[model samples]
Target chain A: MTTPPLPQWTALARDAVFTDPTEMLLKADRFDQTIRRRNWREYAAGVSGVLLSIGMAAFFAWVGDYAIVGAVMVTGMGFLVVMHNLRRHASPVERLPEEPCIEHLRRQYRYQAEALHSVASWYIGPLVPGFLAMQAAIFWNAAQDRGWEEALTDKGWPFALIVAFLIGVIALNRWAARDLRRKLAALETLD
Target chain B: MTQAAEALYRQAGAQFAPALARLARSVERDPEKARDLEQEMHCALWISLARFDGRCALKTWVYRVAHNVAADHVSRAVRGPQRVALDVIETLPSAGNVEAETAEALVLAQVGELIRRLPPVDMQVIVLWLEGESAADIADITGLSAGAVATRVHRIKALIAGHFQSEPAYGVTA
Candidate 1:
């Protein structure tokens, strides 16, 4: 059979009512409110983390565990650093929606890739000082109680596991960033 | 919203509202969900118009923002039906033929089915094409080169033709 004439696809919505400008603006305001609410939630979580870390550091210091206090203080600093990073990269500068789709998509991919690429510094590195201090405190305590040999024997596996987990996280982020960059490259060639 | 933005939105709503509704329907099958999607598109368009500097044609900007919102919606619906690439689209079964008095309605439904199965990029191209946009205009909206748009349009046409061929009794075309 010969191909029949195509229908006017726009006719499918011939009776579609144009939403009023006031209603549209209301919807836009609601959308903005939703985004603001989400941002507030993220801030709440980050603030809670910082406050908890600070409280922990203070308690540790009061108990005369200066080593743990140092570790806790470093961890508190880590929370602040992480919060800053999250806020910075939480969203890219809002671009005009009039921009071409490819450009918008590229921006999104680049934003993600950049965030993942710096995961080691902002995400992983911040915790390293605190992690090491805590480990050192444990090692010193065990060594004083028993001996360095027993401390190494007893704590070796746990230390190795922590190191392995951190490395794994960094490696995974690197792989994801690479993948996003590859997608970015592909999208670049699309237009 | 500023008066200027509201004025622009009114213009866009007056001009592209039907097309936008059809676009939402193309992406979302359920009527309730489609209406929600349409409202979302309207909301996005209204906000996006705040930055409208007349750098591009209003039609182009409206379509770009609406399609982007639809793409985001699809991305978030990870558990929804999976879309396919253009090359492999023909392998998928066509929509079951629905009996309607007018061949146009049937063809519209069939085309809608085809659109919903396509990846976002291809879906944008075909939707623009079916809405009577020129290849250059589609290129402007999608940021695809003119040649890329042409190539995709040709492939999409072939796929649509092939899809309809499988159901000869429909006496329909897209």
Candidate 2:
């Protein structure tokens, strides 16, 4: 345990003019404006999702497709669930000034890990029932026209594809969660 | 931002900009990215100061914001497997022998390289220590215990001292 004089790295600061506070403030103002605009866009997009879902549900119901209507409603509910989960778990890009670095880091890591860990429940689960119902409805309708075996052969691939895609999403999220947990564990050792 | 907050931001920039640059450089190997990181730190600091409650010293607040930004940048930019633990860094080979006349820029670059390899916490501690921050200040800024900061400082000093031309280690000038 030696207390050695460090190189004169601070001298670099002497001649360095990093940024003007006024310039930064102006930049901050522009940044805030941009974020505000982006947030409006996000809200608009979310509203569009809800409206589209509702519109589709209504259209399907009017067309005498109760199963499709049910599927649309469930999928819309899934969208809301996913949005809620995101609001709950998402970490802000800006950090509190007074919060300690380690605490901040820990909080961020925890949020990311937890979000990924529960991806199936909040992200994938809600949509799954809808997908299955829709597939089942499609299968049932097809079976009414064509034979059951013929319908399965014709409409089954999309079902398999959807299931496979959901599985892939779940796996990827889990893997990402595992990696974040490992990093979090390493951070914990510092405590 | 308030007038006081603006004044504080100016003061912090004047005081810690160099150290912040060094921190950014240590965390990012690319000079361009380092500059971007430094700008990001400034932007974060300015934004953070709007809520400054006068609870902590301006320096502490400044460094905390800057370090947090840099830590986040490192976390986002570099994935695991590239950063090594503190104990692992201790076991790694030193910069080897250096002539007394070794240019300060080269030594600084070597220091930056070595620092970039460290885990985030240790990296923050050592960077603050290098910038002449006391152990208590480092603890306050990093949220590590004072004793933890001290232990890290001691080990980091010993580790970095190996790179310089010094007798009894860590006595090199420039």
Candidate 1 residue-wise lDDT, B1-174, digit = tens:
898888888888788888899999989988899999998888778778888889888899999999888876765575755666676765334456556455446557777787887767788888888887888898999999998888888887776566557677644343
Best by lDDT, which number? 1
Which structure among the candidates has the greatest TM-score? 1
CAPRI category for model 1: acceptable
Candidate 1: misplaced stretches above 4 Å?
A1-8, B2-4, B28-34, B80-84, B92-117, B169-174
Worst 10 residues of 1 chain B by lDDT: B91-100
For candidate 1, the lDDT comes to 0.79
C-alpha lDDT (0 to 100) for residue A43 of candidate 2: 73
Chain A TM-scores, per candidate, are 0.84, 0.81
**Residue A76 shift from truth in candidate 1, angstroms:** 0.8
Q: Could you give candidate 1's per-residue lDDT for residues A1-191 as a string of tens digits? A: 12213546756677776678867657767878999998899889988988898888889888888888888788778777877877887765475556787777777778888888888998888788888888998888899899999999999899999999989998999899998798788777777
lDDT of 2 by residue, A1-191 (tens): 12324646666645655678768768878888998997787677778879999999899889999988988888888887777666666637456745788888888888888888888998788778777888888998899899899999999888888888989999999999999889888777675
Alpha carbon deviation, residue B118, candidate 1 (Å): 3.8
